[model samples]
Target: MTTATTGDTTPTPRSRLLPQGVGVIADVAAVAALLAGGGRPIVWAGSLGAVLAGSYLLVRRLGQPVDRTAVVGLVVAVVGAGIFGYALRPSPPAGPAQQTTATPHSTDPTAGSPTPGATTNSTAPGATAGSPTPGASAADTPAETWLADVAAVDGGEGWRHGAATVAGTEHPRSVIGSTCSSTHDGHESFNLARRYSRFRSTIGMPDDAPNDAHTRFRVLVDRKVLFQQDLRLGQTATVDVGVRNGLRLTLEVDSIGTTSCGDTAVWGGAVLRR
Candidate 1:
């Protein structure tokens, strides 16, 4: 009686999981095949590895035990991807081209010019005696230099007009012994030497009249006025009217009507060094 009847029982849950395992294997193979055709080899490897690990997880979800080796492989793949992402980044661009150096010009053998970097400021070094001061004007021009250098005083410029020669005229009317007449109250008379000169001279007021009649000369060097005498008629005296530098040398001479002061009577001059 106890020997009983033959009975059938349901299989364990794990027995049913074999089909999911097969499905996971198919999914992993499909993912791997797709990744294998990717353009980049590194991307293909990473994607294939990830898909395999995902298949293993799916197998474990379907009641199969997870393999520790598969978890380690997935971790290693992730680390490798991070390293690749860091190392394979694009670098900065190549810069512009470098500049080319210029070649020196060939020298002429017959020329007397010195070679480059050979000519110095002065002939000798450590020669402080002949060194020039910082603010020195052309204050020491020799006689030969002075005679060689000449320039036009003023032409179509400033208050004075008409051409006034620097060299004294033949038998200049105003000299050491000459008798000159001061026609107006403010008339400038000048003394002449063997080498007498005038920088500027005028016989009449400017065309702009009294406003522009005064001449302004910026005295650079300390100057001496040889003599300024008021000679009306048959009157004469010797005097020294010296002027210092930086001072404005103004010669404001009055006029005797429109056509009175001849060129010879009114004279103005400056002595400058180059």
Candidate 2:
């Protein structure tokens, strides 16, 4: 008995994908969007969709005799990848930086002032001014006056060790840091007089400061210690000097351990407030 067999012509798993033409449209759109300087959303969506569609087309048509969709899709993916990488590359480091924010002041005619001859200013949200008393919290600034920045005050002295103002674009307060040698030991002073109320500052090391920086930062109000402690990189110690004792403010920096190897100290920014 002789058996005759017929050939089977069923499509295999690895055969050309059904939506061959869809990939072409996706690739073109993605490349066009990328080349047109499109923003993140459009570029990302286009590129991602193009990559998946293009890859599927390329793989399915790998052994096909003559199909331009696979090659074109592959090119679009590569080009899209290159464009995406370039567009998302990190920006260069910014130059020597300075950043500061304004202390929003209230605009009420009947608002109370800090002191008789002293001016006042509004603070961040939730600030209320109270009448001056024997023990007034710096937080209880009066509504009528504007609090002045430390650098803007008069008789501010004693950054003998070395002082520099760093304005942080995003920080609420400007940063006043030291530019002194490793073994720095000195006092910086600011006289608020009767013009300002809340006198305060924070002791900290600058961002990206050396690991070996060791500092004993101190804040003194009228010869009385408000805050005194050791400060390290990325550590913040706050000092609050009320307007009742707002006559004077001083900053003391001393390297405690390791001889101040990277002892760069910062104490005040918007130091005097209301």
Candidate 3:
């Protein structure tokens, strides 16, 4: 008598369960990686999945047993793929950084107030004369006074004292200087008390001035002319006059022709340096 053997070596349900669960988890992770900007993570996940699947098929074809070791490897691979996908995920764009600036404290009690005897017929609303320009630092320069700060004693005809625009540039401290006619000149006088050494300014026509606008600017110390220039539209002059030991400072603007139509002069950044 002889004994016969059967070749029914199918894997048990318990043995297949772990690998199937791990495979499902890997597929889910790959889908997630694809949804979250599929770049290197998708490629890595697909490659690992293909390798593990191929190994499983090869083992099956060779009639080898699907053991606990194989299931553990599948679990490890899935876990690693998940970690890699998470690591390689795209990040959000960074926002602009916030900035903080501190304003310097002023030592002079009267720093922002208008100087005594400084007068203007009309001032722009919220105008502060004799004050340092916005963003100006007291420690940056010597003690100084702006011509726009002092009140005019003799004349301010057609002159508006405050911040104004000239040649498309904004002057934080300036005077809109103008004149009515060639004969009747517009002027502004300040009692300097012989305190300042130099007067400095940039003179130009407003950007909106007519093309034919023409005028002459004069700086006088104690009724004596120090600097004079004729300017037309788009022309600018830098005035630097020595006013040491001078009692009065005057700025005058007159028309070049008969009438001063469309003449909008700007005395920009006019200041006296000590």
TM-scores for every candidate against the unseen true structure: 0.23, 0.38, 0.48
TM-score of 1: 0.23
In terms of lDDT, the poorest run of 10 residues in model 3 is 133-142
Off by over 4 Å in 2: 1-175, 179-185, 259-262
Candidate 2, 126-222: lDDT as tens digits: 2423224434544444532312233423232323222333223223443344435333336656555555656555557766567777677776677
Candidate 1 stretches with Cα past 4 Å from truth are 1-48, 51-70, 73-77, 83-88, 91-214, 219-274
For residues 170-261, what per-residue lDDT tens digits would candidate 3 score against the true structure? 88778777677543348878876656689988998877877788888999999899999999888888999889888788888877886446
State the lDDT of candidate 1 residue by residue for 1-274, as single tens digits: 5887766776555543344444544444454454435434554454455555545544455543555544544444454444335334564465655545676654677867777644233222112222233343333222111110222221111222223322232212211110113432222222121121223222222232233222211211123443333323222222223332322222333323333333223232223111
lDDT of each: 0.32, 0.55, 0.69
Q: CA shift at 58, candidate 2, in angstroms?
A: 99
Q: Alpha carbon lDDT of residue 7, candidate 1?
A: 69
